[model samples]
Target: MTDRRLASVGTAAESRLPSRYLTPMDLVAMFRLPSVETVYQWRRKRTGPRAFRVGRHLRFDPVDVRAWVDAQRKEVAV
Candidate 1:
């Protein structure tokens, strides 16, 4: 039925939607950094996870941020 097709299409679209975007302040709280300025400094040094500009503001993809955090992990032996 056409209704069934439409429902499937909507589900597919939702699956393709991007993860939540994070603002600088969100990143600060998520990482417990000193301030948002630290994020900007990381951006300048190209040492932080990649970010994209949305209009005039900077945005980070949650997936990318999580991957970056995972990459920073170090294993410690007891």
Candidate 2:
């Protein structure tokens, strides 16, 4: 598939994902960061990925998180 087509597919798939889920600590740990508190700060600043609450718990869709991380990876050309 062409790059454009692939990108379109990715965009569509991502759009179907939930925008909220992971708790501040979960997010930080998933990202392998140092402090969980930083996740909260990011939420307050609205600079990190979107998140939502489910009852008293927070969660992040594994697929969405993987997709987002993959998108951020640097591609190296041969």
Candidate 3:
């Protein structure tokens, strides 16, 4: 079933990567971003949440992503 397959994939990824890190595709989905390419562009411009290289793959810390999202919030005077 699809759920079983997804669980297996998640387990495999967890074994390979640190629990605190997320792939660029994860970021795209989490932030509802346009595309993976947009993630790359943000990385290149240093305009997005901080990311780091993990054996040629990009990884993001959820803490950092949360902070970035908080910093981006706008307040309105009512």
Q: Best candidate, lDDT-wise?
A: 1
What global local distance difference test value does model 1 have? 0.82
lDDT of each: 0.82, 0.66, 0.81
For residues 6-72, could you state the per-residue lDDT of candidate 3 as single tens digits?
9999777546434578899998887798899999999999988899998899999876776676666
Angstrom error at residue 20, model 1: 1.4
Clashing residue pairs in candidate 1 (N, C-alpha, C atoms within 3 angstroms): none
Q: How do the residues 1-78 of candidate 2 rate in per-residue lDDT, one tens digit apiece? A: 699999999888777545656566767766798897776676689656666668875555657566556655633221
lDDT of 1 by residue, 1-78 (tens): 999999999778555535689898988887799999999999999878789999999999877876676566632221
Better of 1 and 2 by TM-score: 1
Candidate 1 colliding pairs, count: 0
TM-score per model over all chains = 0.68, 0.47, 0.67
Clashes of 2: 5
List candidate 2 stretches off by more than 4 Å.
1-23, 74-78
Best by TM-score: 1
Alpha carbon RMSD to native, model 1? 8.3
